[model samples]
Target: MESPASNSPRMRLDHLRKEGSGETHSRVFELEPCDHDNWSNPRFGSMNALEILRETVRILRYNSSGFMAIAALLICPVSAVLLSNVLVDLSLVKRLTIRLLLVSKSSGLPLRPFIKQSCQKFAEMAISSATCFPLFITLSLLSKAAIVYTVDCSYSRKKFDTSKFYGIICKIWWRLVSTYLWVCMVIVGCITFFFLVLAAVCNSFAIIGFSPNLVVYAAMTVGLVFSVVFANAIIICNIAIVISVLEDVSGPEALLRSGALIKGQTHVGLLMYLGSTIGMAFVEGLFEHRVTTLSYGDGSSRVWEGPLLVIMYSFIVLIDSMMSAVFYYSCRYSTMESSDGEECQSILESVVVSPQAMDVQ
Candidate 1:
């Protein structure tokens, strides 16, 4: 005696029960709610710097074994070489330092008291970096690829698969290398431009009869501005590397995409960069003091202290790379939420439903 309209709900349930298997019923019902939740909850974006750090820690905890393996196999040797400066040619560095000094003296520019030591250190670093270029292009880039892949797997709630990551890396290696080369060029260009501008300002002041003190103040001002610009460039380049690996972009295209992605997240990126820089500097200082300069009891401490510091440095590198990946996700999520909300929701729903749809078939 019930009205047809009142019976419609029960009839639809009965129809579903008859038409769909138990597994399909559960899959459809359970997955639909989860998909809605995922679409509503979008937890990946709009995180502050501290939140990003927290997320990185969470990710590390989730896949500590995989990340640690990556650090040991790929990052540790690079860290050791860089920290110890083992491959740097001292004689070549000394020659380069002398040449730089001679050029500066001939140019009649005023040299500060610390200029000689700074020049020497700079030459050594440049030599070391150049000598290690192959390693950076190969192992360092590979490590970054592995880290990014692992992070993606973690977010997707999947275990790290070595074979899968290797396949992904094989596909993305050239793109990553291209992006890295562009990043290097951009950084070198920034440094060159900074020096050029500083030199021009100093030369102009000299020609105009400015006081030495004023010139020093002017140089300091320029340095401050350069530092800010350089930091931004580094952040952009780091993000660009992530973009290149995650997307089908590389080089200038990847850099452009990164710039767009980080529109609302610059502060977060800067703070992350600052923290990583401080950690690295602290570890390097400890290495220099404990292992290199303050060796005790016939320098036996170096045997353990050196490797330990290298491991610590490698850990910092791993963390920095992980942060970069997390930051990319944050920025991308925010961008999608802001500009393509409906699209994002649809994509999430589709992703959740596709497997169930296949299972039903």
Candidate 2:
């Protein structure tokens, strides 16, 4: 049997195509690999999650610069969020929303004041939303650049694919913001639906003068919403990131592509995301549960949760970085794409091996 020059030669194949050409007709004899040389198979069809995870770590560890750059990017998000809270108070954006909602409801408020408040808050949320993706992308890219482009890194000699990074940013920038908007909308909608349900139940019982249900209803509603949002946040955050690692599409396109591919198989990928997030969140929760209750400052109520949360969030960021690598793997199994080419992408395909025949030259 003639062997195909390019493709899953591991499946056992015969091929006929012009030399130096990519197109060819090849056949496979068995379901299993006839040639086992290809580990980084684009199909990624065989490896389990554990094997993928092992390969992922191996790939990252290949270059020390890659590792360090991702590390810095990991820290950037936590630092930005904490600093933004302390120095800028992003809730001010939501505060504007609150003031507007109030003005709208107030009959005594003048028309001019109502419009002013509404417009101001609307403006704030918009600015906050817009600022978000860029900040995240900048911090991430800056860290990647810092590590990948370092002049003295051992692997610096490996010509960096500069287009790959920009492609990632393009694929994630708008995606993170828009999907996040949609996710928040979904969560708010869910909570609102449940709130109304519980509210009705509460009002019925309260009217009989049995008991006020506001606290219980509110607590239940809040808990359900929090749980859903927290879990979704981890996955969506992964989506934002998985979208980034894609090289074949822009931000919006990657979202569409990934969404379509992730439909039935999001469990492992989502776990790959939320698992890390939950682990970090558990650490943060431990701090809140045991540490905060134990460590109160002299004049400040600060339990140092801020810094610890920041650190844990950074660890999430690292896991996020690592997960993106797997996302690239999982993607190939299902044919998702980005605007970037494989040459420019981070995914590495294994060199498929095949049976050989000694040739007379």
Each candidate structure's TM-score, on Cα atoms with residue i matched to residue i, is 0.82, 0.49
Worst 10 residues of 2 by lDDT: 348-357
Residue 279 displacement (Å), model 1: 1.3
lDDT for position 105 in model 2: 31
- Worst 10 contiguous positions by lDDT, candidate 1: 6-15
lDDT of 1 by residue, 96-125 (tens): 999877754443346776657666876877
Question: Judged by lDDT, which candidate is best?
Answer: 1
Clash counts per candidate, in order, are: 0, 12
Model 2 TM-score, all chains together:
0.49
Off by over 4 Å in 1: 1-45, 102-109, 342-361
Give the per-residue lDDT digits (tens) of candidate 2, residues 9-116.
Answer: 121122436688878533211223222234333433423345445544544555545555556555656454533332344566667666654543342222345346
* lDDT of the structure predicted as candidate 1: 0.73
lDDT of residue 97 for candidate 2: 64
